[model samples]
Target: MTSLFAQEIRLSKRHEDIVSQRLMLLQQMENKLGDQNKEKTPQMQRAETALQRNLSLLKDIEAAEKSLQTQNHPVPPPEVASLETLYWASVEEYIPKWEQFLLGRAPYPIGVENPNEAEATIQKEVRQ
Candidate 1:
């Protein structure tokens, strides 16, 4: 264990790593579940349960980190906090609510165009 600040960074990293693991797990499980050639074994069910539990734990850890940031005087390392927030948020859109693993739809985060908003922005030429 480390200081709160250090832990923040560590947990942030952990969260990211877990997200990747979980997503990969989800995909793997999805394939297993879909394959009609094989029967669903008890081991497969156990693995699914384990993944959900781990995801829940990670979500709890993130919530605790946010609370620490709010309560503490100093902002807990700025770079760590900012990056953690970004990583957590980026994954948030994908991870399903507890017991709600809808593998059919993966909310992969990506950049998208908002033409209306882009048009609203005043360019230098328009300003002049």
Candidate 2:
């Protein structure tokens, strides 16, 4: 890949990471507010407003990505695609522990599975 292509890929992945973080935050807020008996405080009201805004933003991002793809954006080659898929799968697995830390449900954000172990598992899955 050219340097410019590499940079574009990095930027795209970063955008995806930011979107995932926003979704996680929204999920955390929703879980906290799941209790119907709880009164809506100012903070809760703010969270609700933010949730709506985030949902709208997420929809817009998805639509923009679809438009770009339809407009002939370059697709990554198979090798890059496979590696990216594995990278994202690992990220998805780690996100829950990070979310728990952010929500104060955990003291630290380390994933339950060892990184090496996770890599091995992913490689095994790929081989199969």
Candidate 3:
């Protein structure tokens, strides 16, 4: 039997792609409408056709999603669930080192070179 979890993920990705494509088509149609002539050119005709197809696909995806939701699925065991939790936490913490290098910025533990500034902040906190 096919895994319901995998099927759900695939459907989610497909839905996102179709929605993005639909938005682009809408933008193209809007731009065509904004032109001074407002004539229905071949390009505009194709855009309208594609938009209709995208809408149809979105409807199909929604139907499949509703069917999927009705079915019951087994849950992962505790150890597996804990590991998955840790994995997602790491993903959240990850800041790409390559991106930081390209931006020429200080990496995470942004150092305080001025000891006096650090001391002053501590003293102010102690006073409060």
Candidate 4:
């Protein structure tokens, strides 16, 4: 099933698309007005006004989107976040070592400086 957040994202994308179309139209109008050598015409003034309004509206939409995101998916607690970090860290550290073992090569610890401790670890693994 689709999620509410996913639906909202689709809606946001639609709004952004419409905004982009309007922005392009506004730019075209501005360019047409720029080509005129006479004093500012009523059409030029109207185009400038519409452009300003659209810019403000784009800002409002962005602000509203950020507010919705913050309200719906707030930051996780520090402890929960730290636990996730540790889980990924362990996965990153062990996956290659296990892969090497599966391929029939003894996987040595990556950063062991003490030779005796490293030997003992290997011996324990062999005994197991």
Candidate 5:
């Protein structure tokens, strides 16, 4: 009976060791993941800031072009009117697309599942 109890105690120690190793590994993984997530936060913020800057610059350019057209054709020149009409049409067509591009994606794509691959692709293009 004593031998049987000793064997059971040994088995329990082995099981405890296995559980301890698993817990240690899990803690290490959590720490690594936390570090990675921290690294990605700043990268995501930069990407978002860049995208906003690009969109703002594009809007500014478009507004300047419209202003120039208005100045050059105070009396509604046919060319200016045509240009204005086309510009607005283009804006109407593109605003939804741009909104979708800006607001529709996961921030990080390197390690996690990214639902915003499309936006990420646009961000990549803008960076290039």
Candidate 6:
């Protein structure tokens, strides 16, 4: 009976040592995770900041393009007169017949107000 008691005590000690070793390993893993998180957070913040800056720059470029478009002629010289001629020709062909359903005489000399206004005006008139 005494020998049996000694065996039970030794088994209990072994179990306790195993549990302590497992706890130590778990604590070490938790510490490593904490360190990794600390290292990663600053890098993530810097990336976020860079992304925001790039987005802001893109918006500025778009705004600049819009401003430039409204300020002066959007089309180059060689394309301008050709585009105008094509536009007026299409208008002469399409608009009056589509709306009134009868072949009407073409308007004489469809003149543009100015180079800047010509493309937009022609597009609007053609849709009619």
**Which candidate number has the best TM-score?**
6
How do the residues 1-128 of candidate 1 rate in per-residue lDDT, one tens digit apiece?
A: 56998999999999999999999999998997777435656668888999999999999999999889888866578767766766576457435532143554534323224555434432322333
As for candidate 1, its clashing pairs are: none
Best by lDDT: 2
Q: Which runs of model 2 end up more than 4 angstroms from their true locations? A: 1-72, 111-128
TM-score of every model versus the real structure? 0.27, 0.31, 0.27, 0.45, 0.47, 0.49
Badly placed stretches (over 4 Å) of model 1 are: 1-40, 74-128
lDDT of 4 at 123: 56
lDDT of 2: 0.81
Worst 10 residues of 6 by lDDT: 101-110
Q: 3 or 6, which is superior by lDDT? A: 6
Per-residue error (Å), model 4, residue 3:
97
lDDT score, residue 104, model 2? 85
Task: Score each candidate by Cα lDDT.
Answer: 0.67, 0.81, 0.71, 0.79, 0.77, 0.78
Model 2 lDDT per residue over 1-128, tens place = 69999999999999999999999999988987775436566679889999999999999999999998878868778988888887788778778878878898878754334778666777775764
RMSD of 4: 27.9
Across 1-128, the per-residue lDDT of candidate 3 in tens digits comes to 36998999999999999999999999998887777346657678889999999999999999998778766545778777776776565445544633575487845433234678656754554444
Q: Model 5: how far is 6 from its true place, Å?
A: 3.7
How would you encode candidate 4's per-residue C-alpha lDDT over 1-128 as one tens digit per residue?
Answer: 46988999999999999999999999999988786635567778889999999999999999999999999999999877876776676567667866776687875546455778756755554444
**Pairs with steric clashes in candidate 4:** none
